[model samples]
Target: MNRIELATLIFDRLVSEKEKLKTEFQNSDSGIGYFFLDDLLPNDIALQIHDAFPKTEQMVLKKSLREDKYVAAQMNLYNPLLEEIIYAFQDKRIVEVIGEICNIENPIPDDNLYAGGISMMGKKQFLNPHLDNSHDKDRNLWRVLNLLYYVTPNWEETNGGNLELWPNGLKNKQITIHSKFNRLAVMETHNNALHSVSPVTYNGYRRCVSNYYFSKSPLNDSDRFHVTSFRGRPENKLSDLILQLDTFLRMTLRKIFKKGIKENPHVYKKEKP
Candidate 1:
């Protein structure tokens, strides 16, 4: 189905749970704010999206101590349905309703797909806890929310690749939100929203469609410009030290170069028409 049709389905589902989502996010506001809703779309449609994921070889392998996964923002090369679903979440009707649910006003969807798109994590791959880059690609707008839709069928928390939130920091245990099939999780992004994905244990892909909403104002007055920062899991002290140093160096380079020495290629650029 087209994006408009898909968006209608999304809005209907979300609005149906508006009150529950509002309270869920508010109750968590003392730390990182988040709310998740399962079965965001018809099971058959979600399965179709899952089946449309491109092979890992067709995507960009972003491997580092910081993160290990395959992501694709250049959507034209993949199945058309992938692009459709990604932007369907961007539809104004859905975006506004989501902002209302989270008590964020006038949220704007990112059309450039800067750091927004599809990702797949297979066996042994994982993302360390990190704060997302503070702003949109141009560093003009504050990134206020992350929209993650998981489509992998029959996935389980024990199978791994679960979403971990460090509301109390890594020194304490994290709260796990299973990467369940057809689950759509909306989490607030700000200075303190440190999150990551658990390592995938099974050989199946933990596929997700991601989108971010931006706003002219910061979520917290304490929010400041910072590069994406990373830290190893709680058990890896040495790795944590190294990753902290990595973040320091990157932040220092940005302080000198403003936009850093190299550009991030993780954005979609539509063909000149």
Candidate 2:
């Protein structure tokens, strides 16, 4: 089957296993929830999406304070079938199903796709541990969940580029989530769901399709506003101190300026009046 056929099949399966996947995600102790649909799409189909992806450029490469890695081209890039898959998740039925599993009500996706895009981690690229921005670009809705669809073929554990969840913080340890090909990992993103991507060691790249779902109200009352904060790994003490100061300085500016130095241009550019 092709990309369309494969995506349709996976969508159907997710709908079918909605209840079970929800239970597993909710019951997990790490304050994170995810499930894998193996061979979700054939290798050829997944590769096609990879091949169809446009080239890397300035507009998409989102660099971190550490300057090691960054996310690229987010807003449902121009591929026909990929766009279809993205919007399909927006269907009322599909949204409700995901909301049910997540135990949230009436979830709405962000109109401005912030921090959702294809992430490319090249050799030596690294993403410091951080919590995603608490709200969407406009601060209208609370960021409730993150949806990541990885399509990097033959990506292995040794490759060193994996999603790490630091539920307990850097002192305790982290749960490394593999960025396996054709695997979809959906997790709740909040103040406590601290996470990051380990540095990429391989010569090739690890590419992923990212999307996020937000709601009018936060999943928990304790949720509060924050930026995509970051910190170095446990071993990188000096890097950790610098990153901490970086977050503090930026956050302080936001506290006084209310909107920061300027509106972040990383989001989709809306038409001017």
Candidate 3:
């Protein structure tokens, strides 16, 4: 029907399957933690979401990949139902349960939505492997978890546009999490958790709903202050060097200007009705 109904339906399904999903994540051998539910929502509903998403004009890129690897729409559209569904996940009870799956205790999401929004990628677009920024708007809270819901139908693995986790760093092999339809993949975000979206090779588009959960405490003590760090793939040594320098320069700038050289414009800006 609408975004709310679809989100609610998906939430109900996920809640109903919570125990199993939790167990799957807990038992996984991959330190690159995740849980996925198939056939999460009806095809029609998924199509509606893909169709209804707003333009990508307000989207921001932390690095070159967001521009080269992604062409996405942000979901700040006002819909009480969608908010309630998001709240269902935002609620402490749900967040705590998910936190338990990720082996974290008592987690809370920063009310301010930042780089959190929707994402879409078309052919030739690809997000290079990178770690999310450690903090939110004011740098007061640490982003601890990433909630990604893929809604693109029949998105094939061969087509690319999947999430990749490099828990062991870019030198080693990465764990690729397919951007499957109706799959909700939640992973821990931190300084060590290097991740990215594989390039979309096919002609079609891949769409996803993305949100991040933040907490007062850093995911780990070693997670020192840093900006969103990015790197080239294992094979791209030159790109890696460039990205490292890019991160260092940005972090250096942040040291000079605490809030950032300029405000990030990716956030949802509301206008009076």
TM-score top scorer: 1
lDDT for model 3 comes to 0.72
Residue-level lDDT tens digits of model 3 in 1-273:
444455566666777888888887777525656777777777676666666554445444333633373322223553333344344456555566677667776677654457766666778788887888888888888888899878777889999999888878777888888998878888888778789888889998787777788888987888888888878888888888898899899999999999998987666555559
The per-model lDDT (C-alpha) reads: 0.95, 0.73, 0.72
Cα error, residue 227 of model 3, in Å, equals: 0.4
Candidate 1 Cα deviation (angstroms), residue 19: 0.6
Pairs of colliding residues, candidate 2: 74-117
Candidate 1 worst ten-residue window by lDDT? 255-264
> Tens digit of lDDT per residue, candidate 1, span 1-273?
889999999999999999999999999988999999999999999999999999999999999999999999999999999999999999999999999998998999999999999999999999999999999988899999999999999998898999999999999989999999999999999999999999999988999999999999999999999899999999999999999999999998999988778788999999998
lDDT of 2 at 164: 87
Model 2, range 65-178, lDDT digits (tens) per residue?
Answer: 654654543444556655445455556665677788777788886555676755667788878888888888777788888887778889997897888888778998898889
TM-score, each model? 0.99, 0.88, 0.85
RMSD of 2: 2.8
Ranked by TM-score, the better of candidates 1 and 3 is 1
Pick the lDDT winner.
1
